[model samples]
Target: MADDDLDPTPVPPRGRRRQARFELEFGDFEPAERGRRRRRGTRGTDDRSVTSSDELTYETADPLPAPRRPRDRDVIVEADDATYDSRLVDRDQRVRGRSRRARRADAPPADDVADEIEALERFEDAIETVRSPSDRGGGSDLGARVLVAIPAAIVAILLVAQGGWIFVVGIAAFGLIGVWELCRMFARTRPSLVASSAGVLAIIVSAALWGREGMTTALVASIPLIFLAVAISVPPGGMPGVAVTLLGVVWIGFALGHAVLLRDSDHGGGIVVNVLVGTFLGDTGAYLGGRLFGSHKLAPRISPNKTVEGLLIGIVTAVVATWFAGLYQDWLSGTDALLLGLAVAIAAPAGDLFESFLKRDAGTKDAGTLFGPHGGVLDRLDAAMFAIVAGFYVWLAMGGVS
Candidate 1:
């Protein structure tokens, strides 16, 4: 017999009593909902029926739900695509004002929200600038380069012509500025700009006053001062700071001294002019040639733009330009001109590469921006520094100087 039949006057089960109480309290507000609940209760009772053996069993067995299929990669991907498409459709509908009220429900106040949006926009712009290429030192303007170079060339010529304390002072000024730039480049080493500048000035002045001997003396003497300065000012990374300090002194200071020595030599003005012509012309030639016909890299590791073709063209241009410049100076013979041209040509590129190496190590595109569109003082004179030194040695070898 059914359980309901057995419980005819059995004081109604607890569940039936509770259902009756709920119905009495709420009355029949919704007859359809009440009928649905009654059907569900009947089904549940059938699920827990008892057989003649007093063992509970389902009156009509309902098979267990079919086991869910394990999802493969393709099925998961398809589901994700479907979800994304649905989201896109929903967004489109919202933009068309189908859910304007719903969308505005959790939004912040208008003024506060506007300010937050503006702040976010500014932050994104700042981050974009920070993410810009680090090697973007802009000195590529040709007109600006020429404008700066012309005045600079005139000043250099005037200084070279006035060989004395004026020239020495000029060289000292260059050394000081170069020291400051180097200190800046390696600022993390905490190199003292004053100390390095003093050392460089001493080296240049001594070269002018006492030639090679005084220059050597000053270099040896300045080492102690540099050491003391590094210890006093830049206490950390002592060795690196000292090394960088000495590097500026030797590299820039010593090289510029050779320019003084060159000027002191006999017929120095014409010779200096010839060297400048060769060095600058060679540089210009290399630039043009590389732009026109650069196929193979000259030094891919040190400088990406340098090319073998450009180097050859520069050598040829230097030789021709030097020979042409030497025509005005009767003392410079064919052999001497050739030798000086080749030396300057080779040494100029070496100096340029050396500076490039330094910049690469320092992670900078230019040493400094003092020259505006031409780059730093070092950038402009890097090749000239080596070329001048090379010309001096050639002059000494040829017995142009007593």
Candidate 2:
């Protein structure tokens, strides 16, 4: 029976039998009591099927979103030989730039500083040129004047050394020239010739009576005589004339009378030579030193071209020359030589400054153009006159040649 039933089941087939089997299997699970159990069992299987299908879709079609290409910051770049070389060149350029900066920092700004210094030097040069005698067109006859003056000076020195009327005559001549120069200096003011002459005559007379017992008396008498003469010969100058006449008598007449007194001394020739040589050397040293190393002005208002360095060098040169003269002539011991040298050094510059003061007062660049480069008789004699007077007094005090 079992065999027949199994075989015939297919034969029963058709719609009615199939519907009957579906109802028989599903009808038990459709009841409210078993519905929850049926849903719970089916949900697990559905989730498994959905999960498997989604995994299959992802593997087959989606391609995993291309693994999300790494962001620029996270990316790693491998260097090639060309990249390495470029990096090295960049490093080398950076190093070169740093080196240039360092070198520039270490060096001074030479161009700017040099330009300023050069400009200052040029300015000083311009100032000097403006004040220099050569720039003022006054050195034209310097060479000729020096030529005549040197020989004439030597002759006068020789004549004075002979110690006779020659000295007296020379003194008289110097007094006359000095008086004439004074007159010329005040010519615009119409200085009295008679007063000037009387002053000069007083100098001559005082010199003539130098060794006589009445020398002081004659010198004292000359002043009143000069004043009287100025009063008598007052021209239009009035009191101005009298004042100038007295000034001439004291300045030229009295000052020059010392020269005659000095010549009358026992060792007059050596004293005169020493004073002259020392003063000349001092002047020469001043000129050379000023030209070579003049930076600071000695007297800016009075003598703009004169320099402190020049003045110092001149004094030192005068000291050296005087010292040498002392040694050669045996006129002074070493200590006395040094002392005399000091005196000459001090007095010479004073004389020069005094003459410069006079010229400034007179509104003149020089006393006169008589000796051209030497300026005038007063110019040549200024330092010598002061130096001789100082030297004579110093020697007398030291008991050297008096």
Candidate 3:
């Protein structure tokens, strides 16, 4: 054979290339039978065209096989302002003899859409974990918590103008708010105005009675006297009313009342700083350590965020915080300061988780709305009040606030 005859045909231009061909094996013929065929070649009729044996040539004289119809396309889209055409445009737009499909590529497939929805739900959960309830910026935002903390910081700082009185005022305001929150927390179950008033009265009376009338009188009044009055005013079988009322009297009334007394001292600012710094340091250290090295969950049912690692770090941080407070106050040796630090480290979180338990039982994210950016004033100050009382008791036991 001549070399020119033996050579394969030259490659066609890119645009003039034939459609892709498929190789059929014993079992691979089904898909090709279903696919559209290239219709460029016509049947033997015109002089210029060539015919291939592969195509089905139908004639009147030859017996015909069963007619084969093409399958219809199945596609559906649902949009708010949609304008889809019912007609199919068959032209050069599609490969010869092949159908073209039109739809939004960004729109996920029906099967894949479930995954996207699951991812969106996970994103929302992550946002809630990082942000506080009051930290919303018209929606979910983790920085909302910091925005709330800023105002609280400003209030704490500017109160230097009030000298010793700031502590008393701050404590008293916190006390009343704390009492109101406790009342509201249990108000839904027991909705008697008289009962609510009695609870409120019991709180105020306990604080005054303890702060002035002494611990013995306050304890007596808080137990039998308040409960007796509450039992009479509140209807029978209202444990929520009775228990919460007594709890409010002791937890808010007496503890916060003592916090005011501490703030009114000569170094009240230092005392307030001590309680706040110790409690906040424990909270901060716990959060960071837990995120970094949380191998085991601590009290998962009550507060899942806490961890063993976080608790230990919190204790160390509380000690450091108390040392700083002692330096600022210029009172107490390192040992006494360390003791108070240890006390706050252990007690503050107990108080916090206790409140978290109450909130969980109540099916509430916040105690109330008295505080705008911090849920409720009680929610903001619960730990502070608890730590202050515990620290004060320790200070008195260790020679009474130097």
lDDT values of the candidates?
0.74, 0.64, 0.60
What are the runs in model 3 whose C-alpha is more than 4 Å off?
A: 1-127, 130-142, 157-166, 191-212, 215-219, 222-237, 264-268
Give the TM-scores of the predictions, in the order they appear.
0.64, 0.61, 0.58
Ranking by TM-score: 1, 2, 3
Cα error, residue 320 of model 3, in Å, equals 1.1
lDDT of 2 by residue, 270-369 (tens): 7777777788788778867886888999876566677999999999999899889889866457777767777878888888887777765565666766
What's the CA error at residue 275 for candidate 2, in Å? 0.6
lDDT, ranked from best to worst? 1, 2, 3
lDDT of 1 by residue, 283-390 (tens): 889977876787898986567778899999998998889988887777789888888889989999999999988876775667878887457889888999999999
Report residue 227 deviation for candidate 1 (angstroms). Answer: 1.4
Q: What are the per-model numbers of colliding residue pairs?
A: 0, 0, 0
Best by lDDT: 1
- Model 1 regions more than 4 Å off: 1-142
After superposing candidate 2, which stretches have Cα over 4 Å from the reference? 1-149, 212-215
